[model samples]
Target: MAITSAGIGSGLDINSLVTQLVAAEAQAPTARLDRRQSDLQLRLSAYGQLKSSLSSLSSSLGNLKNFSTFRSYTATSSDSDVFTASSSGKVSKASYDVNVTALAKNHQLSTDPTLAGAQFTDVTDTLSTGTLTFKFGTTTYDSGTDVYTGFVQNPERAAATVTITDSSLEGVRNAINEADIGVTASLIFDGTNYRLSVSSDDTGADNSLEITVADDDGFTNDGSGLSLLSFNGTDNDLLQNEAGVNAGLTLNGIAITSSSNTVASAIDGVSLNLKTLGSASLNVDTDKTKVKTAITAFVASYNAFIGAVNQLTAYNPDTNTAGELNGDGVTRSITSNIQRLLSNPVGVLGSDFTILAEAGITTNPADGRLVINDTTLDKQLNDNFDKFITLFSAYGETTDIYTNFVSSTDDTTVGNYAVNITTLASRGDLVGSAAANLTITGGSNDVITLDIDGVSASVTLSAGTYTAAELVTELKTKINDNTDFSNAGISVDVTESAGVLSLVSRSYGSSSLVDITGGNGKTDLVGAAATSTAGVDVAGTIGGIAATGKGQLLTGTGVTSGLIVEITGATLGDRGSIDFKRGYAEQLGNYVDSLLASDGFFESSTSSLKGRLEDIADERTALADRLNLIETRLRSQFGALDALIAQLQNTSSFLQQQLSALPQIGGSNSR
Candidate 1:
């Protein structure tokens, strides 16, 4: 008979034996793989914690790495009803007396009351179709004669034109409003007639409106039809409801005028918002609250980072158990570098505060956390606040006031470097060879095309007869108001000397270019023959080594590789030297950046740990395959033993049967 199961024929527990043998074969290797996997997982987790804590610490260094963070100032006004003030950057701590003399107003114009017959009877009344061009200028109106004595165009404001298509009174108003040309129009009904009221959106003396109508009825300015709305800086067709004027004020007994109610140029770092006509006392002071808060936050962040590291690398002597990163070389190196940076002195020039210790910041030896001495910090803030800022931020100073330190790269070396200038920056100019024509006629000599600083634009001058000064103002206004020039921030200044007109670019350096390309009015405005000249960049040397120049920016070479400075003064030759220094916060921030980069220590370490874990999984799979083979072989051997035992029993049973039969026969015969 064939043995169906391992111990069926032999009556032995072969299945249990095979199971125990297979488990014994797999136990030791599987346990080893599991232990290795668990350790690698713990290491990966520890690295994640370290990376997270370092990121937090880097974030805390933002305000401490820049000098501008400590340049905050507070401004206050004694009387809020009159004015309110705010300050920024570095401002002197002082008090000033302010007196408001007059408030600014917007210019408003309406249809003349005397022209009652020209008024619209209803909102839907038909208006003459024509182009209405609005020009911005400063108008000196004489009320007694109802005539404008002088008009000067504002170069900063561009002229806007509105075309009337709907022709209805309401349509005209809507069309003007939709233009969005810094002007608003409204229809007002007063008892008998409806009149259109137009107002300037800005409040300034030079922001006045002079509306000129190109009537389709062949009457340009006859005080009838579309012409009734024409002012032209001299017509009485439009009534002046309000005059545009500047806001006048006295700051510390000195008179000041501003186009808007908010005045910023009167004070160095303070902006005064005028509310009413009154006096108020203005006070400016340094604000130290933010600095103290930043310091406290830095301390807290530093301590938290230290605590995370301690937990990640902890060891229990009694249990004989060590933390995941207990003896990790990378962790040790990171902490050591941080400690070294914190203990090093910042080489700040012209200041006694060269380290964090001078500002009452020190490291705790026991836990490697930062500790602050409040009394010492308070004294530093009171006495040398600026110096304290330089100690913890990237700072630079120049010996000459004209040479200003702009920026530097990480490759730039610290310490002083001498600055020597070979040439000063200048702007491009075009001068006229002969006297210019003062009359500009439409469709003849009114348009001109120019290329200024690589930007091209076409300008159309207004048709009129003007004096030399008026022509200068007109040229400047037309050229500066061109769409391309205004958008690109390119401008030119026009001046007249003995009937000759000259144009100059407002920019500096070799790229500053002003060229008269082509136009109908080019010859008339700039004369028959004109001279064009291009600008030149500023040249210089730093620390006796040749440097590079771009406009007013002078970049150093050699030891000062990436150092950049702006030269504003014209005085060439020995200008002075710039002293550059990096503080603790900046240094630490750079180090952290390197460690957290894409190919940084954190990424590499984590990747290696994951790779090891995968290898452990592969090894466990191989061990399982071996155990399966061992189980298969043990079962086969036990099955053969069972079969052999069964066969032997069968043979013995047969022999006993035969022997019994023979013994019985012999006994019977003897009897």
Candidate 2:
């Protein structure tokens, strides 16, 4: 190792001087880089604030984009404990008196105690070897006759059966459980004996069970066998624990019956869950408080966003300190646009209800936070609820071309569509045309089975000779006469025009099919020209892009996205469009989205600032490298000078010693 010292030979601190010189050389450059780095880092932080505030503002605008959000209402019941109700904004504000007469009950039946006593020990023990089938049906009561009708078979679900062997009853129960059928089985003890019981999982009169037990051992359940578990009157062996019954209630003096206590479809958008037999007055109304709360949240989020922006772009006169984005054009533009939007009134809605100010929402002059006038808002909501809803939602004006136009959030641009319909939808029809002189005849034994919708009904004709008009009248009367078809909304229109008779379905979809089957030999009687035509779908294009048409409705996606206009009239070529306009919330949301999206200007600006920061970092690293080189060169020069000075000192010391020795001898003569 080489030794280093200061002022050892030349009486000067050369090492210290070299260090001071190197530091002086590095100071200005390092200071400059540091200042640049600090400025870049501060600007990056400011960009982060911008991103966060914009994101927060964007997130808060989600629910406000829908007008339904403002139209939302809450339902209240006078007896909340007995019944609870909820609304989905579609229901009108009305007071309805509801009487919960009875709740639905499940049907349950248990086997006879005498039969249970015949069972062996252990649940694994089986009593017979056969299969037990279960089916569900309903029973209606004839009040006039005072008799209950036979259980009507409903063939929607096939009967579920459980096969039994000489095995444990527990195994049988497990098998039934694993089947995941509608019914559940278990062993019950009735004080003296344990009986096998089964129950229907669903409640209602239509969910009553019919259990049929069949055994290969010839054990017939003639009122005494163990294979009988049913609610039929003849089954005296089994005991009925409970009878399935429908929930009966009255709404505003109107008799209402439901299969279950949870009745949702009975009302347009309200779910009524009956709890007990009681009366409750349900007052459905517009929940203005909830809408106000949502509006308040939006205002708060927006204020927070603007607050962050102001802080990032503020300038302090005393400290002569300006924020990072104070002079940025984008920041100035963003501020101006938001302020303008917030100040302006929404003019689409009428003059009376245009803008937030008219709706009782006003901005604070100091901070731009929205403040609501509760009383005024309540009055507006009560006076004109629909108009208030239309304020935040785009309502397209119907034109001669299109009738029902629905605008959504994706409907950003306002324009019309030149619709050209190449084909219009046609309903399926059966033409029963015969020879000009043929007369339709019907016998008493002749049965006409008509299949409409997905249900079929048969009617035995009365013996008569009928004309084409009479036959059409009879068919229409019979189809509408059936209760099932009427309840299923099935209608058949039979027309006789120009000596030709035809039957057409009222529905226009592909699922709307009508078949006339089982006429026996009546095919020639009705004159074999009976035929069906396929229903055609409305096909065309909208806004130069191919549109999807189903029946009378035409919808477009992509270029014409959110375009849903129903074609009610037959305009073959160039059907006009409904003009769509954007609402206030939608416009604001779109602007915010543009500012914060992945390819947004905020991201671009942040990237540019970070790039400059990277450049500053590189300059700082280079300054450090130069300082190292300068220190190395200064140490080398000082080291050489120290060596030369040390050599001179040594030479001088030797000469002094020689001179001292010679001076003692030359003191008297010559030195």
Q: Which candidate leads in TM-score?
A: 1
lDDT of 1 at 417: 84
lDDT of each: 0.84, 0.69
TM per candidate: 0.90, 0.75
Off by over 4 Å in 1: 1-3, 12-15, 72-74, 86-94, 118-121, 142-149, 220-223, 285-287, 318-321, 348-350, 438-447, 457-489, 645-671
Rate residue 175 of model 2 by lDDT. Answer: 64
Every model: Cα RMSD to truth: 3.2, 9.5
In candidate 1, the residue pairs with backbone N, CA or C atoms under 3 Å apart (3 or more residues apart, or in different chains) clash, namely none
lDDT of 2 by residue, 251-295 (tens): 899988877888887777888989999999998888777666666
lDDT of 1 by residue, 187-300 (tens): 998877888899899888888888888889888767677777787754558877888888999989999998788898888889999999999999887667677777777778
- lDDT value for model 2: 0.69
